[model samples]
Target chain A: EAGVTQSPRYAVLQEGQAVSFWCDPISGHDTLYWYQQPRDQGPQLLVYFRDEAVIDNSQLPSDRFSAVRPKGTNSTLKIQSAKQGDTATYLCASRGQGSNERLFFGHGTKLSVL
Target chain B: GDQVKQSPSALSLQEGTNSALRCNFSIATTTVQWFLQNPRGSLMNLFYLVPGTKENGRLKSTFNSKESYSTLHIRDAQLEDSGTYFCAAERASSFSKLVFGQGTSLSVVP
Candidate 1:
């Protein structure tokens, strides 16, 4: 089975620029999640979707960040007018519906804000 | 409040040594997962657990729900094993949405 896939392995943008990251999850997975990893830090949940419906996004910077999984199969996370603090690695992961299912992660997109 | 806490913020070990990384959660975590982010910034799942232990080659992980802690032990550490290790816990109310620890950076030098 193919693991979660993400596009644009690396990105560089100046302040106020915009960037979008795409994710295609594994087949037959129901839960998709987005996490942000700062340099030398753990991955923090930004948002999540369960079959095209957002399950939670309280941690997300909703003002400048948005995510959608329209078909429950693929997802996109967008950052508008990015700031210096927005520079991080965006990681996408997917897992089946279960209490303890393993999550498959994408390689992630490294974003640099200048 | 942070639900998850990790220890040994960083460690350095020589090749052929062993080390353990730990995570403790404050919430009622029913499940735990471990991951390794390599130098290239790839997050790879190492283990997922629910109050038990699982081993794969040189990596072994254990999660004790009752104790609200999890551990990842690396045996015969190698250069490739050096990376940032993160442990995440799923609370009952979160419905599998995991809260992650700060992570432990391990360096195994040959």
Candidate 2:
């Protein structure tokens, strides 16, 4: 089975610039999640969606960060105005519909804001 | 609603040795998962547990919900085992929403 796929692999932007990360989840998976991992740290949940509906996004920075899963299969996360502190890796994961399902993660998009 | 605390922030072990990593939870979770983030930054699922133990090759994991702790034991460690290990928990009633730990960095030397 193909694992989750994330793109651009890496992104470098300047402060105040806008960047978007894209994700393509695995087939037959209904639950998708987005996480941010700072250097030397664990992944932190930013948002999640079940099908085309968002389940939770309380941790997302409403002012600048936005995500959408329009077709329930692919997703896009956008940062309107990047900050230097925004340098980190953005990960996308997907899993089957179950409480104990194991997560399949993508290679992640590493963003660097100068 | 709580968090996971992983122990021994970092560890170095000699190849062919055995080492154990732990995760302590402050929340009331029922399911737990362990992942290894490799040098290239890919999260590899190692084990998923529910208040019991599971073994795969030289890796074993146990989750005790009552005690709110989980452990991962690596036997005959190999150089390929160098990476960061993370444990995540999901609330009993939820649908795979995970609360993750800070992660334990492990390096197996030759």
DockQ of each: 0.80, 0.85
lDDT of 2 by residue, A20-104 (tens): 9999999989989999999999999999999999998989999999999998999999999999989999999999876468888
Model 1 agreement with the true structure over A1-114: per-residue lDDT tens digits: 788889989999999999999999999999999999888788899999999899999999989999999889999999999999998999999999755579889999999999
The parts of candidate 1 lying over 4 Å away from their true place are none
Least accurate 10 contiguous residues by lDDT in model 2 chain A: A95-104
Total backbone collisions for each predicted model: 0, 0
**lDDT of model 2, residue A98:** 62
Model 1, DockQ value? 0.80
Q: Evaluate all candidate structures by whole-model CA lDDT and list the values in order.
A: 0.90, 0.93
**lDDT for residue A27 in candidate 2, whole number 0-100:** 96
Angstrom error of the Cα, residue B33, model 1: value is 0.7
- Tens-digit per-residue lDDT, B12-77, candidate 1: 999999989999899999888898888888888889898999999999999988888899999999
